[model samples]
Target chain A: MNWDYLLSLFMGGLTRGSIYALIALGYTMVYGIITLINFAHGEIYMIGAFTALIAIGVLTLAGWNGTAILLIAAVAAVVYAAAYGWTLERIAYRPLRHAPRLSALISAIGMSLFLQNYVRMAQTANFLPFPNLIPEFAFLKPVAHIVRSSELVIYAVTALVMLLLTLLVRFTRMGKAMRATAQDRDMAMLSGVDVDRVISLTFVIGSAIAATGGVLIASHIGQINFYIGFLAGIKAFVAAVLGGIGSLPGAVLGGLVLGWTESFFTGYVSSDYEDVFAFLFLVGILIFRPSGLLGRKQMEKV
Target chain B: MKAEFKKSLLAALWFMFLTFPITVVRVNTIERTVAWRWERLIWIGAATFILSFIWRRLLHRKQTGRREVSAGEVRPPSRWKQMAADPRLKGLALSAAALCFLVIPLLFSWNKTILVTNALIYVVIALGLNIVVGLAGQLVLGYVAFFAVGAYSYALLNYHFAVGFWAALPMGAALAAAFGLLLGFPVLRLRGDYLAIVTLGFGEIIRIVLENWNALSFGPSGIDNIPPPGFFGLALTLRQTHIAIYYLMVALTLLTILVVHRLQHSRIGRSWEALREDETAAQAMGIDTTGAKLSAFALGACWAGMAGVVFAAKQKFINPGNFTIWESILVLCIVVLGGMGSIAGVVLAALVLVILPEALRVFADYRWLLFGALLVLMMVFRPGGLVNARRRAYAFEPSAPEKSERP
Candidate 1:
């Protein structure tokens, strides 16, 4: 094996997986609470990228540079995405909450369609170049041999975010409320938890995290497009399912595994068949172990 | 009632205000310039008029506080159905309806005939989908893949082996049915949203294969110059051919309705209904859930295949692009908006959904946007559908309740 080539591929996969993990976190969190799938979550990510791209463009034009531009862009994307997520819940979901499961799903599908077309109409169809924030890794030639500085930055940021999330969910009162709500909505309500507020906050948090992922990915890939969300959403959904939907750490693990599989499969096999591999993996897991690798077996209510 | 009216009106106005930016401001991507679509004002006007009319007509009826019940036992007929279902005039109305169906196409201009033909084609597909989505309660987002399979089977057979349309029709449908069984076997164990996403993935895979396999599917540019079906070995001119095909589509639609309606009352159909209402309980009740699900998938695919064969014959061409995810969404909308399991509802939905956007060519750009909004709004307001299916009580007439109860 060419160690250098494998090392680079692994690095690339890790970067990609970090973003997938971010996106999958949103899906898994929402599914944990309501089990709605949130089909429009991908569009939230896309909107994040767009919002970040515009922020960066404006900031750079106004003479902002380097880390400052990235900071502002990241904040802008997360805020915009959180707002979008909250509105989505309020409009597309809240009314249909008591309706049939199929109806809410159909409504979600409609929301997905509307958002896709809305972005397609609002933005150019073609991919727009994203501003590159990372400096040339000329200074890191000694320590970083195979991986670039940008890749390291991605890893560090992802690790920091994950740590922050773990701390929040483990220690914070609001996080406990979210957890209580996710466990049982009616019980949580009975216990005086603001279930509605918890759900809304979950959406806001998930969208913000996904937006951070989206901005980072846009910067890494060097371009953004309207339709990227659909496929990426599907793949990340597969990741969430792979790890055990509703399990946060499981989502992260699944994302990494999915990313590795894609990288290795593309290196050895046909890149065209990579998506097929992800879905096939999903089917294989679901057939043999429906609860996923980490998910607890849930009993169906009579 | 007055407060309720005011609340609903205020809600509508709020909704109107929220959507105003989207309605009036449209970005022209090609020019990279933003412009106002002032034409949306006309739509706003029309919408307010319709809303006011509905408020008056429907709310006024509600205010009367009338039961209009036949007996206290039977399920109350919706106001529209009650008006249409007079016992003395039932036979006369049935005959009139049949007469209208028979003569309507003949009265139609050529363009309208084409539109009707398209609607009939969707009607058949939607009815097929109704079996799976409505009766079985399985959301198959990839339903169009079966349609594509049938179309391609007919086209490939004709292109490769000189098979005629008549011979290929049943063969195409059988092939699609087999494919359905193939898909059903693996997916039978899954349910609900999991089943939905997996099927969606399968559908995408199928499309990608169809698009990528150049040697087999002609690589998405599509098969062209497919021969239309012959009427009893008669070779007619183009105009005559279109008319003949329209009639053929009509015949096929009637045949589908007959089959689906018959099956809806059959033992298997009851099994499907049982399963749909509650799969675990139905299985506990000795219904073969697997068999019911597989049958629903196969039968639904069978009709879609028939529609596909006709589609290939009518258009005289076929492509992977023609069988897109959007087509699946379109057919699902028809079944849903028409009321899930109602035949008449499906027909009406097919007509309105298929013909309305075409008629409103000025708002063609907003077609899908409106459709998306419609799906959300319908789910919120009328999840049961415009003409939701009502369970028939006559099926239990043998052991009817001794006393009628009023709600």
Candidate 2:
């Protein structure tokens, strides 16, 4: 491939990877803390996108500036998604904690189905064009390649969010509590951590990040749909697993790897099999390193 | 004997009572237009529901005395005894009777071959899935990948090498198995949901490849007019030789079931179960966990490949759309609802899952809703499955001399 084309592909992959990484953080965090896949996290993202879409639409109808409207929409979507995440855990997952892993998984699947179909029923099962929130501007014009202002915005926002999340987990008391709970729930509880509250907060934070990713993705893609979550959810989950499912940094790395793989596959081979290439990469990673790149392998008790 | 006779008589009476209104509705609807059939159908359904409720209540009352007599003697039955005492013989007898009933219709029918052929195709898919999910305890969400591989392999070979169906069949299976090996390597480290997601991704990738690889897969338009299997000098076409294809499908299905059954009871099967029950324990027991898991994937993929060949021949066309995630989910549902690890359960499930939707064609729009509801209900009520495998019981008895140790 030509350098210019390669450069564009690289940029595209990076931008897309950033979004995947953002969404994947949510998966990694929830999995780290509760060992649940949080299957509905993608739906939470979908809700966030829709929430932003609605918020923007309403604001624009009320004659608000595009920048001001986007800011409000982002905040509203994150808060709404966080609340939704909190309620979802309380209602579907909390009681099932003592149940088998499979039961919780099935419940998660149920919640996913309920949310997806509920959205399908509520909204028309078609892609709704997301209005351009950020104006298009060329960041890199030297190589005849242009980066949209939206892409730059998404990358910056995602990086900022990731940085904030890292700090929150590393430095905050609640973050330490979450880490403790994740290590051993019983011990965490014994240590006077409100394990339940910590878990709920984890979901809340994860959902908020996912919501942000969703809005960014919607804007980047310029369209949103009810079924968008299905593939993205799986991919994000793959990213989580690839990075070492429970590790935050691993998720970001996995997401970038996946995004790069897809971009290269599409660039070199064909766009049609982009999904296939990505999965093959995932499968390859799993075979060689089951613990993922950054994940620690645990010995199963016989 | 007298009580048995009375119970049989009552059951027959109840059956006739429920059937009477349905017959009446059918007769009445014959004079009216077919559009009004729904109204009559509703009325008949209501009547049947009421009759069944009353019959169940009466049966419940009569069973109370027998319950008291059998109280305090609840002991587990031996596996052999349980198998021998199974009431499925009546179902077999009923099927035999139904076959006889259909004999005259078959002679006069034109679509007999198609119905049987379709059933056999489903049987193949079910049996293939049984090897993966049922025998191995590995949840594969993108089984359609193998199916697609088989179909496309056949298409490419037929077009390029001019290989006939028989040659393509083995080639297709081999190709799918190769892909399975490729997939199994990475996913060997992953378990359950992680493996499932990867497999799902693999499937979508395959589909997208089929859609985008225009030179090979012909993109989304797919390969058309796929040639049927030619045995010796005879060409098996859908029109004149539909019965031959039907028999071919039946033979293939039988072969699939036999292989699956054999594999399920083999050492490999035991290893799979060991891994499923406790992977670490299996590994500790000297089982090569990676090899076992790969074998599961390869074998499962091989069967799916064979099914794909059959599907292509039956349809005389192959398209990417035919292999979708929903199709994979449906197959997964079949294995789950059929009772995991039980061959008979999977077969029964496949039949019901396929036939029920066909039977409910009139309620087409509500089919998915009903299917989803049934899945949720089944998981809720009998998550183990309809014919849950009996748990192996230990023949442990407290020794009189050892009793003081606990005290």
Candidate 3:
């Protein structure tokens, strides 16, 4: 492959992978803390996209400019998604904490189905065009033909959010509580940390980040459907696992790897076999290193 | 107050029933016929309920003089005490087995050959899933991926290579098993929900490949005119004769059941149970946990492959949509509802799941609602399944010379 073309492809993969990484963090965080896969996270992403779409529509109706509309929509999407995520955990998952894992999984599946079909029923099954809120500036026009201004915006937004998340996790008191609860819920409870609150807060933060990713993806793609999250969610989950399920930075690394592999497979081989390649890679990694690249191998207590 | 509550409830039901027709008449022709029939059925159902209540009361009054016995408790028989004392319960079970062998085929109408064939197909799938979910305790969400592989393998091989059905059958199973091994290598380490998520991803990936791969899968139009099985020189197709296919399916189903039953009682089965109960302990016990897990995956996929070939032959049309996530979930539901490790339970569960929907065609829209409710209720009340697998007692006999040892 030509070096320039390969470089561009790599960059493209990184951009896409960053979005997946953001979503994967949500999965990894929840799994790390409670050992539960927040199956409804995908729907939270969907809700985020819709929230942005609605926000854009309302802003446009009131004759807001592109910049103002984008800012307003992003904030609204994050807030709405965070609230929805919190509510879903409270209603569907909270009561089932003491129940069997199978029951919780079933309930999660049910909630996912309900959310997906509900959206399908409310909105037309067809893809709706996202608002062109981000302006196209020629800042990167000299460097490459492939990189669009919209893509640059996506990269910037993702980087900013990730930085903020890192800072929050590293320094904040709430973050400490969240980390403590994740390490050992019983111990955290004994130490005066409200485990339930920490868990809820974890969901809210993760969902907010996922929502941000959703908005960026929608803005980049220009159009989105109700079922868009199904594949992306799976890929993100893969990314989370590949990066070591509970590790934050691992999610990012796994996302990037997955994205690059997918992009390269589609670019060189066939788009049809893109998933085949990705899963094959996953299987290979899992067999060789079950703890993932950065994850510590957990020992089971009998 | 109870009597008044009952009367008011009855009045409310009656009023609603009467209003249902006027509402239907106001709508279109299709709506009217459906509504009218449903309302009339409700009225007839109420009358039957009243009659049954009266009959039950009379029966209870007539039987008042009889001694009452506790529910599900039976008195020991004096005549058969010697046989019953064996403790194995095998002697007691032979009669039930004989009754089942005689009644099942005769009780149901044989005219619905298609239903029997479908049930057989489900039985095969249930057995296949039983290995992964029941034996291995690995929750697989993309089981239909193997089925699709098997179907497509047959279709592609038969059409391009001009291979016969018999040749394609084993080839298809092998191909699916290979994929299962491939998927299992990475995911075998993950447990519970994590494993489930990965498998779900795998299933979606397979479907997406099938959908987008225009060169191979023909992209949505799907492969048609898949040839039927020909034994020796006789060509057996759905159009010519369904009985042959029905018999073939039944034979295959029985073979599957027998194999699974044997496997469950075998050393390998014990290993699987060990893994399910405690993977660490099983590993400590010198069981090759990884190998056992992979075997379960391979075996499960192999069964799914066999079922897929049957499905493709029966339909004579194979497509990506045919093997979907929903189908996988349905198979999983059958296994769970049937009581995971029990063969007879899954068969019965499959029968109910398949037959119930067909029976409730009139209320098609509400069928899923009913199913959802039933699932919740079943999990709540009868989570162990209809026929639970109880522990078999030892058949050892006690000697009558304990006084010598004491002395």
Candidate 4:
């Protein structure tokens, strides 16, 4: 029955799903708060990877240790990405808040294009080889064939992050404000919540999460390019939609579902049409279940 | 003013800090080398400092402008618009524009003629997109897929059989319209952002399939040596053929303008506009939102298909790369920047967008970067577009004061 092969594919899917979950978290959170797709969110992820690579290059040249370099690089990426996210919202979205939905969407698309070219021009157009920072663990030698050490690390990190996020969103006062703002911006504003601050904070947190995903995935893939964000962003958006956009847990579930779907399809069928399968699956879900798996359906107000 | 200066300085510093990692530091990981271009940081600081002032002023104006608009102040129309609206000036402008279009190819060089022809093609495509996005309010990001359908229909038909361009043109439009209807049927129920993503996915799906499906699309290498449109068995040289194609595009563009302008004034067009404004209201008014939306998609696709066939004939080659998401976005930009639902604006924007890059060959590298920034800026400052679409204003005659109400 080839249980081992299936198990490996499962683990691979799990790893991939966690990465998508990381990026999807950003998209879902932003969409939840603003109801805007935040098309530039993917570009934030790419920026995170680029920032991390720059940090790594500098730190390594200064004779820093591996662990310290990784830690500093990750922090740098997150902070820079958060800043980018904040500025992006202020510049591209803030003014369009009262405009038509189409205007904001077009603005977002424009921001995405601008950022892609910005990175491409700032960095080289060619693909950069990302250094593998995750070290091999000796404890998992026997079951190494089933899952690599990086996969285990990914699972643990994703779980820890998810737990922390859940705690923050559920237990904190700021989280309460964020939730209120997401529920209804005008109401929140009337209730004395700083809606603008909440929205900015939402962008910061989402971009930070996306940056973490960007760094981890770039390290895993061992390469970085300016165009990576577009496809990954779309796929993650799909994941966010699949689970029920605007729901955190839904994003994770959607990511896992999308991951498994792609992994299994690639494993059994020809890998050539793997992307087609994901898109077709999305089309199917959107047609049959427009609100997604966990999304609440709201009646249109006249 | 001093406070504004302080704010600008702070913004400049914040931007410098934000851009430090990417702009100031260049890292070559494989070689373990890092280059610090500190000058770039200075440039960023200077640029942001100056831009912040302009941005703040514009934002102030926009906020005040909104209030004035909501207060029902009748702002005077711009001179160009007023001239366009006046019958006497409008006729003069139209004749002048028509004369320029007719005489341009005859006087211009071959390359310039070709460039103008390309711009005309975009004018048609952008007008088509204007119908779907501007009129119907469906954000179709994969509009180029239909264009590809038309292009490939002509390419494959000519390659496989002895089908000529004249026969393939209508076939291409029909095929694309069918494809549009196919995509529109199920997706008509979805809302804005979801619809956008689905269309985008549809676009990528088409591109990927074309790239992988070697049996049909000839893979990524694409089909080459496509013969240009036949001229009734008249053998013309290469230059003459290009000139003829230019005239063909001119005629096609005028025809598209006529069709689009008529459609915009038609009953179905009003329905589309109503649906765009409010779906529930439109449906309650018995506008048949489904038919209006589907027709918008199909009609838009129909024009794109025609343009696609023309584009293929012009290039004398067909490739999947020609129909990327970027091309669709370019047309979208033309529609948006020109002012959605404005025919003259779309034509003007298409000409500017297509010809500007060709005119400024030195700034080719920064073309997309500038386009991206322009989009954001346009949305922020002028969402109404370069030339705002004028609503059909009917003269309202006020009734004389009644003697009974005078007391």
Which number leads on lDDT?
4
The residue-by-residue lDDT of candidate 2 on A164-215, one tens digit each, is 9999999999999999998989999999999999999999999999999999
Q: Which lDDT value does model 4 have at B205?
A: 87
For model 2, how does the per-residue alpha-carbon lDDT over B321-382 read when each residue is reduced to its tens digit?
99998788777677767877776677778777776666577755444444544444344444
The value of fnat for model 4 is: 0.84
At residue A59, candidate 4 shows an lDDT of: 88
Off by over 4 Å in 4: B399-407
| lDDT over C-alpha atoms for residue B18 of model 3 | 28
**Native-vs-model 3 lDDT?**
0.75
Model 1 residue runs over 4 Å out of place are: A60-65, A140-150, B1-78, B87-101, B395-407
lDDT of 3 by residue, A1-302 (tens): 58778877887897789889989989999988888887778878887887777667656655667698898888988887787788667656775566556656655665565556545544446787786677778677686467777778878877887788788888999888878988889999999999899889889989999999999999988887778777678788878879998999899889988999888878777876776676667666666887887898887655
Two-chain DockQ for each candidate model: 0.37, 0.12, 0.11, 0.83
Off by over 4 Å in 3: A1-11, A54-72, A95-107, A138-145, B1-116, B160-163, B166-171, B185-188, B201-221, B231-240, B355-407
- Model 4, A1-33: lDDT tens digits are 999989888988998899899999999999999
Q: Residue B67's C-alpha lDDT in candidate 1?
A: 50
Q: Name the lDDT value of residue B39 in candidate 4.
A: 96
Candidate achieving the largest TM-score: 4
Better of 1 and 2 by lDDT: 1
Write the number of the candidate with greater lDDT, choosing between 1 and 4. 4
